[model samples]
Target: MMRSSPFLRGTALAVSLVLSAPAMAGGYAKSPPAQQSNEESRHRTLTNSPSYVPIAALTATVQANHRARGLLQIEAGLEVPDAQLRRRVERYMPRLRNAWVTALSVYAGVNYRYGDIPDADRIAEVLQEATDMTLGEEGAQILIGMIIIHGD
Candidate 1:
């Protein structure tokens, strides 16, 4: 019978320990519980938690981005004929929409936090200018189909 090298034995033991540790610890039992039903769990967590706010805001922003993306897709479908142009437009659409929505959402959320609507509008105007410059006229027009212009 061949003798195993000390180094190999040590490596094998280490690997064994790592592989078996979780099983020995009662794997499933160590895991967290499943979330409760929607209605029952609705008020269980703190509403004002910073961690929760960002997640909720991110979700809402993502939804808004999806809407913007849909609008862009529609516009691209109407405007572009060739497959290559359509594909390129589709690929860029999500990034454009997400950037715009995230900027708008952040501005609005910060303004709401401070109870300052006018300032938020001003900031939004600046954001819009930036977006328009970045996106150009055609891109701006596509985005406009999704977002409502509040003032002018």
Candidate 2:
């Protein structure tokens, strides 16, 4: 039963670090951390495909009993079969999003209720019309992901 000297403990720690360094270096030398992350992210982005464009957080004011209660958040995506149309969709996303926000707001104001489920078919219809109207053609298809109503 004895205490190790400062020199002994320091030497032991240094030796352990020196022994572990090669293994750690080899592990990372295979692929740098940042590059690995970028590769993984690129793989995911590819798997999702350029055809599917995500539309996130389309919210509308939910008014109940003559007062604002909460908000109705709609999440959706567009599936365009044509790569050219997909590029156009991305280019016109700002205008398309504006049109959708207006349409969705109106739909939420008219159709949605405090304790009722949002009609998926009707919402999709609304979004499709908005898309077609904004894009001035028929190509991209609206795919609804979530219709969540946050209540107060």
Candidate 3:
């Protein structure tokens, strides 16, 4: 049996960690979670708590010219800090999903392209508008997760 050197084992471990680390730009990564500051940890906890309401992945077909091109998908959720507001958001999850679908359809049709990077700000604004319209207030903070386009 061949025993690996300590340096090789350490290097291997580090390479695996680096590969597993999440990319901080343009995509969501879940590495260094423990390194997050206290406030960040609290915020993360809050989002995963009862106050954080999860939304199923919102998807729409990317359309251009006169046919379907690809699928645009985004994962998101609502963070309602107030307990009462959280209850309301939970109750309205279905309505919120519907609104998000409608808004995403519009955005995909007008703003997104099949091969280009997605415009996250515009998408967030669209989702936020839908949220405001459906909830009739601005208590729920929209927490957008991953935004990606699947090419046909």
Highest lDDT against the true fold, candidate: 2
lDDT tens string, model 1, 35-144?
Answer: 43553454333334322211111112212322321111111112333455445545566555565556556554444322222343444454455445544433332212
Candidate 2: worst-modelled 10 consecutive residues by lDDT: 41-50
TM-score ranking of the models:
2, 3, 1
- lDDT of the structure predicted as candidate 3: 0.83
Model 1 spans with C-alpha error above 4 angstroms: 1-91, 113-127, 136-139, 142-152
Q: What lDDT score goes with residue 80 in model 1?
A: 37
Could you estimate the TM-score for every candidate?
0.26, 0.68, 0.66
How many residue pairs of model 3 clash at the backbone?
0
Error of 3 at 13 (Å): 63
Residue-level lDDT tens digits of model 3 in 1-152 = 99999999999999987876755342554446465565354433325376777777789999877889889989887878899878888888889899999999999987776678999999999999999999999989888888988877
- Per-structure clash totals for the candidates: 0, 0, 0
Better of 1 and 2 by lDDT: 2
Off by over 4 Å in 3: 1-47
